[model samples]
Target: MIVIEGLRKAYGSTPVVDGVSLRIPASGITSIIGPNGAGKSTLLSIMARLMEADGGTVIVDELDVTRTKTDLLARRLSILRQENHISSRLTVRDLVGFGRYPHSKGRLTPEDAGHIDRAIDYLHLGDLADRFLDELSGGQRQRAHIAMVLCQDTDYVLLDEPLNNLDMRHARGMMQLLRRAADELGKTIVLVMHDINFASWYSDGIVAMKAGRVVHHGAPDAIIRPEVLSAIYDMPIAVQDVAGKRIALYYE
Candidate 1:
């Protein structure tokens, strides 16, 4: 389990994540949904140690995230940021191979190569494996980044907007991939997303935030309610059971 306590972060004077605490499950997909500037990305960054928190603690299982060694933590958790603008002109395969750095440390063993190949094939990037990142479309580049994150093969994977720029078809495929990663690989997948419907359909839990505070956290059935969503988003959001799943209808 990922345990958070009194976590806080601020950009100079204005605080983004304010004393928020949460417990994320160990082996399922948990989607963090909130409005823009609701501290979703900041909180994820703090949890992954990508950014320093002003106060409080985060513990993944028994290991303290702040105190753990970088390499040690890298082996247990991997994160993909929402905005990754690395201008190195690296190919898809090269970027995915970087994920094995924690274990291989610049030397690619046969085992690491196997992992690289598996991640490429898992994302259906085998055909474009040799394409440069700049050579692909935005959605394809996003998938390449995801492939790199998945190639890490860590127990915990935190993704900030994994579906960004993806078309409907690609978005569905990405969600299914995340589900497979959780059910088949037993990886703890936590994603920060703007799509409530996708969160309801794929994740085991939904964590809603607003104005630097956690408003609600529960199974999709509980969090997808009209009142709950209306309160979190400050607007009317009607939710209904469609087929066998809860679907939100917020668009007029």
Candidate 2:
């Protein structure tokens, strides 16, 4: 389990992630959802140690994120941020190979090659595997990045706005892929998602943040209600049951 205690970050005097205390379970998909500037991405960055927190601690399993050795932590936790800027010209395969650095140390063993191939196949990137990162479309590039994260094969995975630039088919596929990773592989997958309906459908737990604070955290059924949705997003939202799943409708 991931334990967060008083997680706080600020820009000047304005707190971006204010006193967030959350316990993300060891296994399952937990989604963080909120409006823009709600600090959802900031909170995820802190959890993954991609950004420093002003005050507080994040403990993943028994390892303290702040104190753990960088290499050791990378073996246990893998994160894919919203923006990936790779200046070097590299193929999709080359980028995915980078994920094995912690274990392979730039030398590809048989097992590492297997992992890279599996990850590429999992993301349906076989056709684009040889293409350079610059050649792929935005959504395709996003999938390639996710494939790299998966290739790391860490126990914990954190993604920010993973659905960005994805079409409906691919977006749904991404969620289902993460769902399978959580349920079948027993991996802990946490994501920052803007689509409440996607969160309600795929998440075992949904966390709602607003104004830099976590306003709600509970099972999908508990968090997907009309009142709760309205309170979190600060907009009128209607929820309906479709095929035994609660889906939110914010369209006016």
Candidate 3:
């Protein structure tokens, strides 16, 4: 489990994450949803130790994120940030192979090779395995990055906007794959998502943020209501049940 308390970050004086506290349990999909500038990405960055927080602490299980050894933390927790740009031209296979660096230390054993292969196959990247990242489509490149993260095989996975470049078909596939990773592999997955209906349908818990604060956190059924959606987003959002799943509609 991940426990956060009084987590705060500011750009000079403008507070982006204001005293936000959240607890993400183990072995489930937790989706953080909010509007632009709500600090959703900032919060994820802090938890993943990609950025330093101005105040407070993030504890994943027994390890304090700020104090843990870098390699140790990387072995336990893996993160996929929103902006993934590789300056060097590399093939999909080479990128995914990097994920085993923690264990292989630049040497790939049979086990490390196995992990890389599984991740590529899991993301359905076999046909494009030898293709250079620059040669692939945005969605395909995104999958390659995700496959790299999965190849790390960490117990905890944190992704910021995993669906960014994915098409409708690939977006749904990514969510289902993550859900399977959580349920079957017992990996705790936390993602920052922009689509509320997807969060409502796939997430075990939803964290709603606004103005740099967590305004609501609960199960799908509890957080996917019309009143709750309106309050969190500051727009009229209608929700209805379809096939026992709550779907949100905010289209004009």
Candidate 4:
């Protein structure tokens, strides 16, 4: 399990993640959902050790994220951030191959190649594997990046807004892929998402943040109620029992 204690972040005097204490289960999918500037990305980055926290501690499994060695943590956890900018000219295959670096140390073995090929197939990048990152469309590029994260084969996977830039079909596909990774591989997958419906459908647990604080965390049904939705997003939200699941409707 990932345990967080007194996690806090601030910009000047404004606290973005104010005293967040959370325990993300060791298995299954957990999605962090919130509005813009709610610090969802900031919280996720801190958990993944991509960014530093102002105060508090994040412990993944038994390893303290702040103190663990980078390579050791990389072996156990892998993160794909929301905004990925690359200045280098590299093909999809080349980029995904980099995911194996922690294990192979820049010298890929046959096993590493096998894992890379499997990840490419999972994301349906066979057709575009040879194409440079600059050549693919935004959604396709996003999938390539996802494939890299999965190729790392870490037990804990954190994706900051994996659905961004994806079309409806691809977005659903991405969620299902993560679902399979969690259930079948026994991986713990945590994601930051803006689309509430997607998070409600695929996540085992939902963490709601607002104004730098975790206002609530619970199962999908518990967190999807009208009151919870309305309070979290600061909008009128109505939930309906649709096909046995609580579906939130916020649009007027």
Candidate 5:
């Protein structure tokens, strides 16, 4: 379990994440959904130790993020940011192999090679394994990045807007891939997402945030309600049950 206590981050006089305390359970998909500037990305960054928090503590399992060694933390938790830029030309396999740096330290062993292959297969990048990153499509590149994160073989994974620029089909595929990673690999996947409908459909738990604070957190049925989403987005959102899933109609 990930325990966040009074987490705070600010820029100058304005706060990005304000005393946000949340407990994210293990072995499932939990999505953070909110309007722009709600601090969703900031909170994820702080949780992964990619950014420093002004105050408060984040404990992943028994290890305090602030005190743990960088290598140790990398072994337990992995994060993929929204923007990934690779100046050097890298193949899909080459990119995925980077995840094993904590263990291999640039000298890959046979065991590390096994992890890279497994991650490539899991993300269905076997065919693209030898393909350069720039040669692949946007969705394929995103999958490669996610494959790298999974190759780290961490217990907890944090992703910021994994569905940034994908088409509808690719977006659904990405969510399904993440769902499988959680169920089959026993990974605790936490992601910052923008689409409420996608979050409602795929997430085991939905955390709603507004103005730098979490306003609500619960199951899809609880958080996908008209009142709940309407308040979160500051717009009227109608909820409907379709094929045993809650679908939010926010388009007017």
Candidate 6:
């Protein structure tokens, strides 16, 4: 489980994440959904140790995120940020191979190669494995980046706005792939999502945030109601049961 206590962050007196405490259960998909500037990405960054928090503690499966060794933590957790910029011209395979750095430290063994291959295949990037990242379309590059993170083979994966640049079909495919990773691989996936309907359809739990604080956290059926979503988004959001899933219809 990921345990957070009194988490706080600020920028020049403007609090982005305020004394927020949450418990994210293990071995399932938990999505953080909120409006822009609601600190969803900031909180994910702090959890991955990409950004430092002003105060509070985050424990990932008993390992203190603040105190754990970098290498050890990397082995247990991996995160894909919203924006990824790489100056080096790297092939899709080369990028995915980087994920094994924590274990291989630049000297990849056969096992590392196997992992890279599996990740490439998993993301359906096998055909483009030899292609340069800059040559691919935005959605393809996004898949390559995700494949790298998955190749890291960590128990916990944190993704921020993973659906960016993806078309509707690819977006649905991405969610299904994540679901497979969670159910079959037992990977714990945490993501910051803007699409509440997608979150409702795929997530085991939904954490609703408003103005830097979590407003509600519960199963899809519990958090996807009209009252909860309307309060979180500060607008009228109608929830409908479609094929046994609670889908929020906000476009009226």
Whole-model Cα lDDT per candidate?
0.94, 0.94, 0.95, 0.92, 0.93, 0.94
Summarize candidate 6's per-residue lDDT along 74-166 as a digit string, tens digits: 999999998999998999999999999998899999999999999999889999999999999999999999999999999999999999999
Candidate 4 residue runs with Cα over 4 Å from true position: none
Error of 1 at 220 (Å): 0.4
Taking the tens digit of each residue's C-alpha lDDT, what string does model 3 give over 1-252? 999999999999999999999999999999999899999999999998999999999999899999999899999999999888889999999999999998788899999999999999999999999999999999999999999999999999999999999999999999999999999999999999999888988999999999899999999999999999898889999999999999999997
Cα displacement (Å) at residue 228, model 2: 0.8
- Find the 10 residues in a row with the least total lDDT in model 4: 242-251
Which sections of candidate 1 miss by over 4 Å? Answer: none
Ten-residue stretch with the least lDDT total in model 6: 225-234
Candidate 6 global CA lDDT score? 0.94
**Taking the tens digit of each residue's C-alpha lDDT, what string does model 4 give over 28-95?**
99999988988888988899888899999999989999899999999999999877899989999999
What's the distance in Å from true for residue 55, model 2? 0.6
State the local distance difference test value for candidate 1: 0.94
Q: What is candidate 5's lDDT per residue for 1-252, written digit by digit as tens?
A: 999999999999999999999999999999999999999999999999999999999999989998999999999999999889999899999999999998879899999999999889877889999999999998899989989998899999999999987778878988998899899978999999999889989999999999899999999999999998889999999999999999999788
TM-score of each: 0.98, 0.99, 0.99, 0.98, 0.96, 0.99
Tens digits of per-residue lDDT for model 2 on 135-235?
A: 99999999999999999999999999999999999999999999999999999999999888899999999999999999999999999999998988788
Candidate 3: which pairs clash?
none
